[model samples]
Target: MPFFKKKEPKKTKEQLEKEEEDKKAEEEKKILENEKQIEVAYRFLMQPEVQKFSDINKRVFLRKRGLTTDQIDQAFKRRDEKKESAQTGTEQQQITQQEQKASEENKSVLVYSETLEQKLATALKNGFLSIQKSNTTELSPKIFEVSNLKTLVASQNMLKEIPDAIGNLVNLRVVQLAECGLTNDVISDKLFSLPNLVELNLSKNKLTSIHLIVNLPELQRLDISYNNIVELPEDIEKCQKLQLMNIQNNYINFFPHNFTKLVNLKRILISGNQFEKEAEDALKSTGVEGLFKFLSQ
Candidate 1:
């Protein structure tokens, strides 16, 4: 009898290719993970507080976290490039939207020619009274006249100004216009004419002044963050009913000299601005009441 050794079966080409594909997918996932880490590191380093550190200290700190100088530099470069592309894309989109809006405004002449209440009902039905995401198609002019409209959320629109007709909505209670791309001089003073306006949010706009909303006696909450405001509006304390106010992330160098007059304010955020050391310390203390106490002194 002849002794025969069993032969091992070889893997087919298809099997080898599948293994290679799996390995490549895993490597890509890992690369993406590293890229996310680099983005987080970039944001951390770019903070105003972190930037106060010396360059040598920054390098030491980053190295301790396992990041290299080359990686940081590359991250910044990529961020700048992305910003440039995004800005370009935004400009193009804005131009296209403006043209589209103009065309729709002409059609709206017919759509909005009905009675004011009918127009208001139609606009509300067509998504005119809310904060719409960018994925929503073809934003039309959201003009309407409903006396009973209690809440209006018109955020993330390309509005250069709030229309004057909004003043007719006397029963409006809550109005949110965050990220509406409003300019300093764009908003008409008519917006402040709403007799029952209670909550107003204008965060993440381009407003350089806020004098219009100073006398809203029933305003309970007001958010005006991430704007270009250099100073608080005069007579802001006249909003005697205000409870919460957020004016963070602006260019304000100091709190209003008479900030203590706002005694009814329960919460106030003034971070990410150019505050003096004393003011900053006061804010960093126990709470909003402590900041008010410090301002009083």
Candidate 2:
């Protein structure tokens, strides 16, 4: 018996036209975005703040200003050529000096950045911020005695999860993982193992719960802002040294019951959450102290 293969459904002319129109619209949107970025690059190149930075920092500043590497190079090249033209009659030896002087004078400058990942690699080699991933199939569990490491930032990567072995870096003081698409389930609970973690920023992630962080003894600053958090750990007061906590723009409806006990808190950015009307009104009127007092009652 012969078996017949299923035929694929063909798209209609109208559907094809619609797809083309959608593609064109998307391309136009991207072009507009690029044009805006180019304008921003030009403005950023003219900023007085850009004048003080070294070549590497200039590249970083450009990247932060939303300019693509290609745009940055093009801008820098144009600025350099303009300088070369201005000093046409200068001696060849003086030409180099003139170029250097003009390059420093203008707001435009450029140098290559390998990638954020590559920058992280250099930071790792220097023994402060380490990035260790082997392949897509499996991650390497190589632990480091990075006792003196002050900060570890792993942001805007395809990282599904941080390895459990990160806890081995016991002396880590600050950890930033903003905009990494991390969820609570993906992150290892061993993060709390870092006893010396004074600052922890997990902003712009998909975290639904972060009660595990309350165990960090020396945590002074916690930024779980812009997440899916609805409540904090009841024992949040355990972080006796916490001086600042930024939980703004989350799903939190109320402050923790023992929140008042955190007398060390100097700043608590809890706006843009699902707070109750009475509490929110009190907070909006009298501030954090009022909010704490209302919660305490």
Candidate 3:
């Protein structure tokens, strides 16, 4: 008997495509598996908690694990709320306990709109925190300890000067003062020295320039829209970590150089500037060619 003819090798275009797709899928799967393994190994570093409070009512116990104070506080905060909600007459007790905790820790917690000044005064009198925000015009320049505070939001207020004391919040990560009355003359040198600051929102203010906040090392997102910013600082190239900048509705007459220093910039809104022809042409040549709508409109 003649040897059985080998099965005809089938290699159609569809089959080739299928093979390539299968290879890609396999590669992606491997990559995903590796990523998952890496994530599992390092998750502890992402959300460190100082302690795991299983039951605060029983006794204050801290978990001897890799955790930070922030993580621990966050984890227990929700648990405390749930526990209090489940028990009657616990709200009053919680208030007393919170006051005691704040006193002992020498921490500040102020979140009441009913006579803010009065409430802050009481907290300050209790020595829990140094208070600020006495008025819509002036922020206390001696409140935050130049090494503490994590967040500061004083938006929708009428103010022209950002207190030099603001630099005291060296650990600040998020600061939102949008719609505040600010001008180019009201620059604060201390504000630029904040090391941990990441998000800054100064939109809808009377800003006339960008140099005011051009060199924050860790600043990631900046919102300066609705201001009178006509130009950016030449030293803006130094803000290496800046990721997003919104400079809409300003009278930008020229393009700032080294727009390339914004290596991580993913979105830029310049849709309301009065650009000269040369400036407009410059923007179009750069990858930001789409910002022409400002001039067209």
For model 1, what is the alpha-carbon lDDT of residue 165?
75
Cα-based lDDT at residue 140, candidate 2: 29
Write down the TM-score of every candidate.
0.55, 0.55, 0.50
List model 1 lDDT by residue over 213-295, tens digit each. 87678888999999998988657778878899899999998676666788788888888888776777776785677887777
Model 2: per-residue lDDT, tens digit, 46-83?
A: 55534433445455556656677777665665555645
Candidate 1 versus the native: TM-score?
0.55
Candidates 1 and 2 compared: the better one by TM-score is: 1
RMSD of each: 20.6, 20.5, 21.2
lDDT of 3 by residue, 52-105 (tens): 211332112122233333444444454446446542222435544854774565
In model 3, the Cα lDDT at residue 253 comes to 62
Please tell me which predicted candidate would have the highest TM-score against the true structure: 1
Sort every candidate by TM-score, greatest first.
1, 2, 3
Clashing pairs in 1: none
* lDDT of candidates 1 onward, in order: 0.68, 0.69, 0.60
Better of 1 and 3 by TM-score: 1
Segments of candidate 1 deviating more than 4 angstroms: 1-128, 134-143
